[model samples]
Target: MPKQIRIGTGAGYSGDRIVPAVKLAEFGDLDYLVFECLAERTIALAQQRKLSDPSKGYDPLLEKRMRKILGPCAENKTRIITNMGAANPEAAYAKVVELIEEMDLAHQKVGLVTGDDILEYLEAEDFPLSKGREKILANRDKIISANAYLGAEPIIRLLKEKADIIITGRSCDSSLFLAPMMFGFEMKEDEIERIGKGIAVAHLMECGAQVTGGYFADPGYKDVSGLADLGFPIAEVNVNGDAVITKLSDSGGEVSLRTVKEQLLYEVHDPANYITADGIADFTKIRLEEIGKNRVKVSGGGGKTQPNELKVSIGFNNGFIGEAQISYGGEGAEKRAKLAAQILMERLRILNLKFEGLRFDFIGAGSLWPGGSPSHIPKEIRLRVVGRTKTRHDAEGLCNEVEALYTNGPAGGGGVSRKVKENIAIVSSFIPREKVIPQTKTLEVENGSG
Candidate 1:
């Protein structure tokens, strides 16, 4: 077995930058390049797209990204793993096959993990919803998509088959990175401690540049340079499941203990019991050592058995959201913005229009902390009025009222803008692991298809 392997993170989310991934494939000398693209609502959006067009449920940037890095990755022998398939792994697999043929890389082998989508298998009463369980059941007809999170077993099987690239739908984010380590080192499923260590490394690198200082910079307190050209992350994981997080030597971004710590705690509810599809990772005793510049060695993670139930993300058409914003400047900008909000409320009341939800905010004056007063007033404040309604027509009415403020209400209000959009809301549920089945399929490039 290999003593060590280098895995590079290509993306943190569906809309992450493409150039950083290109840099990693070209110069990172990576054995694996993993992209964690899907989020809770991203799959729902992809499902909506699939409903519109059968051939287009995958990541919108899938083609563009494959076109950019496929040739280089094939030439360099760097395998790729990504959940960019979102709602449709088979369609995504077909797209990649076409790209491989077009690029004349027919020798490449691609694999896809399937069966995560369990929309039909789910019942409204089976599991409680993350939000408004009763309301969601009441609006069950509007539900669009439901998908379970697959673990690394399917991906590991594909890797053992020597697949050069792997695509999946709604697989756990860290699984993409963990599969390579498990397959490369021939790790056992019951090795909870080792699995936990692998998970720690995967979590650190899963978000691409998060561990490399992309999201941790905070001006003077936490300064990071070359953020515009920030580099993605790479993990040099050893057979022991320990790893050193780093990046391309010439690439931009800092890799320090602070960055690693911030990423370690990101989105973690309880550090002692960070849960995933694979196993329960205990990060309470994880160690971080800055061994060299832009390199941090990480170890000491424990684990327990995997969760009995798998989490599923459900997407439904919640309602329509109408929003309008107008900026007011000068000494009394805050007061003017508030007055505009009052006018909007009065107008909506006069029209006898009742919305499911309504909100008014002064963008420059402590909108986030509604109860707190601003330390100082800003020269300009943007008044934003938003309303959620059952129908698009009713939502549009809220936008129209805000636009009217440009001429009738606030004297200094300018830069008026309005938008009405369908809100795709998300809810989470769980299903026993026995309910979901994951399997792998291999796709070979057609010999004469270019």
Candidate 2:
């Protein structure tokens, strides 16, 4: 018999449901509940939020989530880890401390991982940007955010110090789970194969419900029951790096080999040479077995050392996208929808909206596979038009034209909704790992912000 640890995936994305996390904290008996919330788009939006107001940059749902799960997590002694800090970990730290005091929960220690924001340093270094980002570098002022993908070392340090909840900014998703494994198993960095196994496990669990059947439901092919009450995944791992991916038995959804395999390959470019901040995992060598109804045993994950350079996600002000959708329900809905699209295109030229690019999508039609002729005529069709413009004003004008179409023409154009969104472009660049130093700040409620 060897030592084992349970780590639960709380969130898969920034706007993921909270009830699943509450379930994990209350009944999953997890030693750690990690929320992987930072994506390139989310990190960019958070940076914009910080730019608007210095005190308001972290994840919008951070307060709501902390309020709900903090109680159960404290009661069950489940440590929480999240990269909800996004653009500002220090401010996130302050806010969490405030919550701790207001809630008056016994959860005392809170740790913040910082020094990931390498904007100034990146600018000074002028490192070679990835994927034509060097071209975008000419418009340097438009760059909204630049954060390095930090590894598990800082988090491991925080865990050893007994931090109740750790907040991070733009950390590697798998690194969030890797830190706990490395700490619990007392695994060293030089231990290559074990580290790779840990990375493989984290990759599968980081997406939360994806490994449990949230995104695997098909009508008749792969019908997954109790989707309304889908449960998040929990990893039971041993010192040998062997893991069992499962969900609460009483909870909804299935965790068979299909679900596990689907998630394992999700967003993975190279199964054989999957790269991460922790180790280069060889997912090809990984093996999965369905030992039970809702349990899949995972083992035989191989790996190599971490890359010398760390990939940095950079977000910049791309443009504004104005989108408007209107529905048509009748015998000849498809015909009317196409006509509406034509009318909008003509109106755009008349108004001189100055769109950089424009696209028309006819929902319930061939929007997904454009240029393909579809003979099946849909009774109800929704016309969706989106245009990209240089300025927000022009973007608003584009949407306004769609709204105007309702009263002018396109009879039966109902449920017209229009909105303008800031278009943020995310790019990646690499920097020497040694240049980006990750520091941790542990604070307590009674200490009044340390």
Candidate 3:
């Protein structure tokens, strides 16, 4: 039988937060650490990185964290897997290998699973990942960023080699720890459902303290003590993969049924089916018990048939969008903002310049001037108008026209600043599992002498 495993994750991770996770892992004595650093904006950042340097795809912060954690884990005999390689995992691993050598860490090997990014193949045949986002893709010929979410099997393969650390692009967040458990226990295929339970455990802990009173808290933990040093949640998983969610010893946070329930609802659209790269998990049948203080016992969960269509994120050139705010004073201030936005869009329409989208909103007025909520507080209102077009020139044109709304028509137009924020196009695309099959290859690395 394999030894009982403990997995912990730091507070919600971005490119900038991976460092702290590594530092925590160094001192926490965890068997495995999983890091999530990819977001919608992360893809954009990766694309933007390519413009200045070819080796600029992965988040440098993630790389730095790996550098901090890699040697320490190997010394302590712990393993780690993280999805910090947003666009390029192999390249990121190469950087890690370079760091290991530079730091003079002996016998340290890093493995990376690639072929997850389908950008090149998807870009072929002029399938420009920008077709749908005309407004953000103005004049851009192709998508600035594209990455596919990979599953856990590849990471399992890497761990088999005792590589010490594994990195890759978008992956089912739960898979990071699941791969370690599966490899460590030599679990069989028939037991995968129980593994699914462990995956759920990982999901709850993936966002760090999220499942431990970060977002959901009882009266006792309402203030969220030790927020700056709030330790990550841990999963004490068994050979069968059943687990309890808790935090490491001496950690600050609370984990209970309510906390687990709070995390179950995070980023979920339906309680019956939550999709992941590995499989689908149903939170509806989940049973939670307040096993102990800062601990929750989970069981009686269910899952569904995994979807055949893999969700692919593709960002292409969406033309451009610009908005300005105008403040109004007095009784009808809120109404003025709304009307101002509408009139600005209408005026742009009269100019005969086609735009992909437009939106107008009032800052404050009778709970948006229709459904008046109780406790009305007098507040200044702002009218804002946004426009998107296929060409930057056209987008700028809309910006120019909307800015003119202040002097030409409605009063109280104030923050009319025409500034270009992001220049590339953004497009979202989805590829069926069949089309993505080609990019799902895995490699094996041997760890110790056989």
What TM-score would every model get versus the actual structure? Answer: 0.96, 0.96, 0.79
Query: How far does residue 186 in candidate 2 sit from its true spot (Å)?
Result: 1.2
Q: In order, what lDDT does every prediction score?
A: 0.89, 0.89, 0.66
Candidate 2: residue 192 lDDT (0-100)? 91
Task: Give the C-alpha miss distance for residue 157 in model 3, angstroms.
Answer: 0.5
lDDT string, candidate 1, 121-145, tens digits: 6663444435456765777789999
Cα lDDT for residue 229, candidate 1: 92
Looking at model 2, residue 201 earns an lDDT score of: 95
Q: Residue by residue across 229-249, what tens digits does model 2's lDDT show?
A: 899999999899999999988
Give the Å shift of residue 142 in candidate 3. Answer: 4.0
Sort the predicted structures by lDDT, highest score first. 2, 1, 3
Name the regions of candidate 3 deviating beyond 4 angstroms: 11-23, 67-75, 122-146, 217-223, 226-229, 248-253, 269-272, 302-309, 326-332, 335-343, 346-353, 365-377, 397-450
How much does candidate 1 score in TM-score? 0.96
RMSD of each: 2.0, 2.2, 5.3
